[model samples]
Target: MLIQKSGHIIVNNSTNIYEEGSIFIYWEGFIYGFNQQSGKKTIREFFKNLQIHGFCSAISKLHGSFVLVLANEEKQEILVASDASGQMPIYKNQDMISSSLIELTERTDLNKEDLSLDKAVEFVLTGFQFGPKVLFDAIEQIPPSKIVSVKKRNFFLINRDKEDDPFLRTVKHDSISEYLNQWEILANAIRKEKVSIDLTGGTDSRILVAILNHLGCSFETAISGQPTHPDVIISSEIAKHLNSHEHFTSIHKVDEDTLISDLYEIAKNSKGINDFVGMHRLFQLHKERAKRGISLALGGGAGELYKDAKQWRCALLSCNSKNRLVDKLVNTGFVGWGMGSQTPDQLFQTEIREKSANYKKDTKKFLKDIFPEYHKCDVFRLADEIFYKYIIAAPRGFSPLMFPHYSPLLDAAFVHYGINLPKHLRFGHQFYREIIAVLDTKQEIASLPTTRLGMTLLPKRIIPEVLTSVFLNLQKRKTTISLNDPNLYSLLRKRLKRSNILKELVGIGLLNPKIAIDNIPNKNLGRLVSLWLFLRILDKRKN
Candidate 1:
């Protein structure tokens, strides 16, 4: 058996090996096999002219995320094949070792002298890395669906293409009744699995629990929040109603001193910037569940499933004025005022101009594909791009953790179904208002049971307006913006003033510099507010 680059490979001369995450090597006299699971058939038969017989035929028939290496150790020749998706990476460096050193050298580093930092930065900013580039210069991913073989020092490329016979899109249902029937199919899928769900007091997760209960699935529910947050209360109620064991944790008052330590641990373990405090708690939760023998955890991710993108589409349909769409976009939460008050049109233009050449190309193609009727609008283009990349991918990445994370809402089947449904059916006439209504209906899941306890911090709602006002005021500008009502402004101001650490960090300019530079009085002043607040909690924990 040979293990290379975090995968298992076995050389067998006596038997036929069949297993997932396992590799089989056929060699002289006997067949050897390695598998993560136990008691698999190792060798089945022997035949003369084995290389020309069923050996190659059987090898070609195997399908999975794996690599196969066939060798006639007596004849001293080898062939290697990889699966279609290349979900399991396989790489070989030729002439780096002799027969005597083959056992010692499990993997070889790739030369990355041509690695591009600019491309890396652009990819990271877009929220996903692409192609074969790894963080390490010496590493490269094996491209999906490729076959490579090595015999002595010579290498051969056998197959390189996407999987043929792509899965067909299934859309047999036409009405809400049919959609409900499809939902039944999905609920049954969840019921058949040993599953746990991250149940926030939100419409999405609540709907999932309701469906699970209807399907007669025995599931466990987990919630994260401050003790008194509305979500905790609602999730607890739903869990009790469903008769599912409920686990709730208070994160609002998490020890400040421990936050930094945990952050460091998270940084070491995580792959991307999108990971934040919530993930750390999730990791701990997974461990606890694993100890109790749970294997699958479900959550309602993919904001599109619950939040209505159809709002933008509806606004586009009813209103011919671009300005109206812009206003509606902001009110509907399409434009992130927190990021900046750039109008939707302006944000669209900036992103189109600045993002990757590939992204621009893809956006142009997507615009044509999704909105063929309308002349190209920067607003629609931008919304579609951001919706798919940042908004959709963030929660999807959670699926790859050590434990399987299942989100039926994000399931391709469900998303495609929702996309084709009429806007009225999905979110009703006034989109955002309708969404809030839908959310309120599932209020049992939407309320948090407790407030996050820590150094008092500005309420999330007022930060944008306060920052905008502070910036405008410092510039000697008087703007009558009714957006920040007095009561909310005063509450946020008190929270800001009370957190000396946050104030100091914000003064230094760290949390989100671009936001600080544009909104704060002093550009560099808010450097470490979020980080410092996070670290201070960690420090207190140690003390």
Candidate 2:
């Protein structure tokens, strides 16, 4: 077995190995190590039994995030498997397989444009790029809980979730106990590493804090931005409460010109990635922690999968009983199809918007497939599927190069209860709060401000609201680097005109080139800037 990697593959012998044998594995996840002999004993056990049971049984029996590829040299066959709920993306075309979609596309022989114009427009409209049909049309991605086998020029899907998998056993008088137990189970999975939790006031990270606090695990926290930033202040309080010291790294401000230039470079290098803007700050935070000698960062990413992150979209797409799916999409907060339709029809310098004009039909079909049992099921479950695909697009595509990041929320055990638990109990994290109430009793789960939902002040709503308002104001003092900024917004518009994006926009005519910069505000500007940066990337990739 010969081992090869582009940066994405884990390089340490502890988790990385290439052998010249029939069974080949690219395992990227937490696995327990034995002091006795085998470095990755947990991975060893799974690999030991994988061939005997085949991919499905062995994969299902294991826990944590990973992709295992088994190749049979003698039979000229190969099996690729991943966690039931996905993490890393696996891209394959009969001749080769890799984790990076851009790398694969570059290496392929297909006569493809650097970026698929139709897909780029679709992504701009929908904030989504599907794996099977992606930014590069000819490539494909492996979704979670799946097995794809290649042999004799034939392909097979070996492990798809049965309907019963979603409705796991997760209801009882002590539902809180069940969830608490699961949390401990997940926390214990991290073994022999310098652990650090990327602390935020958000419920997701707080959940990890709860587990760590409960287990008496000694760890540090890394908080970015300044003390007045709500995340910083609230997380400082949390750190004090947990008795774990946190490193506060102030983000040095950069001017708009520098920021835009950086954004262009980032999009080009990251290959038009999602879920991050200005990764400089994120890495700055991590670098601060690294100086303190902390590695293996943990996040609450993907915890939203269990909550109704997109209840409105779920209802519209799932129920489909509504007459104006396109209208709702055009109006709502959907990063994609949402506001594009609302843009005035006269702005086209050419023909961009028209390329994805029939996107409504595609949107409805995609939504229908994802939410077939929408009416009958818990909205959280539907939201879970949505978050699984889009939101995690950040972590799935980006986490490999960031740090040894772990999301316990994606664990099968953690998600199992989240999925099967009674929908009502799951709402507002009633079950999550109950566990905190039972354990810490005064953890203030309700008072904590959430990024997804705005800050909620419980007990004394008015008083906390006043304090939160003050904190927000102080934080906003430095929030001027925004598309909403009159100056910055103008700069972005001018920059867009100089780029080839408007030319491409004219070709597709999906977006009106004539629309004034004033019409696109802060949120839209972020997307617009992202699209502008994307066009630069597209130009680079195409050439």
lDDT of each: 0.40, 0.54
Model 2: per-residue Cα lDDT over 13-123, one tens digit each:
344543445655556544322121212555566666665775566666555555556566676676666555555556665455655555565556443234566666555
Error of 1 at 79 (Å): 14
lDDT of 2: 0.54
Task: List TM-score per model, in order.
Answer: 0.49, 0.75
- Indicate the TM-score of model 1: 0.49
Model 1 lDDT on a 0 to 1 scale: 0.40
- Write candidate 1's Cα lDDT for 1-543 as tens digits: 332322333442244343222223532211112211211232222222233454443433233223455554454445554433232234343332111111212233211222233333222233333444433344334443345455554655654332211112343436545545555554544434456788765456765665566556677888654555556666676676565555554343334445545545543333222233334455555656677677567777653533334434635553555445544544443432122222111111233323433443343344345434334544443343334432343211332334455555554345445444454543321222233234344433323221111101122223443355447546765423221112322333344455464444333322222232224321112212223332333334334
State how far residue 188 of model 1 sits from its true place (Å): 5.4
User: Residue 526 in model 2: shift from native, Å?
Assistant: 4.6
